[model samples]
Target chain A: MTSDGSGFRAIPRTAAQTRVLDAALTLISEHGVSGTSLQMIADAMGVTKAAVYRQFKTKDEIVIALTERELGTLEEALEAAEAEPSAARARELLLTRVIDEAVTRRRAVATLQFDPVIVRLLAGHPPFQQFIGRLYAVLIGDPSPQARLPAAMLSGAIAVGVMHPLVADIDDDTLRSQLLSYTRRLVDLPE
Target chain B: MTSDGSGFRAIPRTAAQTRVLDAALTLISEHGVSGTSLQMIADAMGVTKAAVYRQFKTKDEIVIALTERELGTLEEALEAAEAEPSAARARELLLTRVIDEAVTRRRAVATLQFDPVIVRLLAGHPPFQQFIGRLYAVLIGDPSPQARLPAAMLSGAIAVGVMHPLVADIDDDTLRSQLLSYTRRLVDLPE
Candidate 1:
């Protein structure tokens, strides 16, 4: 679990690669992976298509890197959670960080999770699949069939809670706190 | 409330228009609204682009109609839920049907809600806006800020729960039942 959560951060990128990923993330959030083009990312970054291609040879590489970066953000929380001895406490800690991360990125990360291309990438990408499996192992703890649904719902709730139109006007602090409490309830954690 | 729920169903369309929408939905489900083009829809339907144009003027029109058609499926449930006197009972009824609808359509309907174009259209389009408002109203009968978050989370839970990769292999009956129970818990209704 420790190694799995750390896998993403271990793969370092150059500053130029990071810049391309940042630009691609913005474009993909707005237009989705299927709708966004390499030329558009280059243009957004004020570079030529050749320059973008130099950084990422293909759109799929950019997408995989973007997902890696996003999941990397959770690496620390996951590490801490993995270290914690108590299952309930680990879950609570992870959920807090997860909610905060979701609120901070809001539309960008949540929206990316739903894109069809990204969905396929996440499934096929080995590191992502391993990292997600670790994330859910802590999230569900019990590993029973019944526990899986609530964990799935909890993940969906947090992802959608931060970005849904219904809560768009909510202040970051308010949304984060609200999500934390509601998510705690969903998992039957003491508020 | 009654009329708002029924608005989607009231809009009539020609058989040709429905065919165009059907093909458009399939393409949009795989490729997003922005990724899909009129020519693609026509190609899928084995018709010329001009014939597809005759059904709908622009890509946005096809998206709008596709959304309407999907929402129309929930019209009956919304109407039934609205007529129920008890708030908790109304919400229970709606969530059950929503879970069924989501599990039945699963990927297509859930994926559409997250599309950037559909999100914008649902926000800007008056009928879509009004219908969503009424749906939320029943879901959160309290009409308070506190209630809004749970209602928002409940919606995300249901949408993401049905379509999430983790639950993808779960049978429709199991998914639907699990969603109903977990969603009821999210809203603090008796399970």
Candidate 2:
């Protein structure tokens, strides 16, 4: 991973940065944080290690940038959730968007989110923590015992639903509708 | 990925197999399915890759054994659920047991379940699919939209709850109770 120092690659105005992100995401997905190297990313991209270094300074930066872009994708939905009239409404809205995003980019969501190394990074980063906190509050409600269990289960289900090995053959449309209907019951939202 | 074909370590026997399973579990949790290999398992076991192969004939078998063992841990609870006279009681029983396992295992359940390669195997495998069908049937009593939504959400929450980098700091008991309470509310189980 190389350093862009821009904190994030400014949307690949150039094809190189886009290639970097695309390659980086797949490698990162396959290799966890500590495991993925610039050489590997470069190899995957059919470029040299230095070629990767030119794109991002260090693996951490690449990871952060990758996360920023991925989270950036969720910004609109998150903003809409924050603006919703009630927590329930916020969750309902987020569920729709979350399902859409997960189904659309099924591989990326699971790989990026579930990577052990990324899991650590997201925890240590304040912005990530805060954003996740907001997301969970909407999905889980107040942190009370009453809300925590369902919240945990609901999130687990969604993460598992689309990517579930069992649900692989279920197709995007079916997965989307099933997830929405199932999670609607989870959060007690209307059909 | 060697296939020891030793059935499951959760059963009442075999110390060496348990040792192997324990090491494999820890390594897989750190490295993921595709990332972890037989050589790694051998090194972890302080044996040759051939020895690891002796326990399991192939990598896929190891994976199946691991999956079976994990599912086996939940078997007694599921059996109780099946045996229960009332559907509501069965649902309550299964959820409680599942929540209990999640809290106890903390990160293991979610991590292994989310790995892409393993997810495929579990789905493609008939026994796993059948077991899960039973699980959902018990968990989801009616196919109503309301019931399906919560079932999906609870499923997401449970997987996310224990392993979530978000809740990593929370103690197991606290996580367990919170998970139980929240999930109960989702299913509208008795407090």
The TM-score values for the models, in the order shown, are: 0.92, 0.75
What DockQ would you assign to candidate 1?
Answer: 0.69
Task: Using DockQ, give the best candidate's number.
Answer: 1
Predictions in order: chain A TM-score: 0.91, 0.85
lDDT tens per residue, model 1, B14-38 = 8998899888888887888878899
Runs off by more than 4 Å, candidate 2: A1-13, A24-53, A57-62, A76-100, A134-154, A165-191, B1-9, B45-51, B141-152, B169-174, B185-191
Clashing pairs in 1: none
lDDT of 1 by residue, A100-169 (tens): 8889988676667888777876777777777888898887887777777787788889888888777878
lDDT of 2 by residue, A69-144 (tens): 6655776788788888888878888888878877877777777777666666666777666666677777767786
TM-score quality measure for candidate 1: 0.92
Each candidate's DockQ score against the native complex?
0.69, 0.36
Report the number of the highest-lDDT candidate. Answer: 1
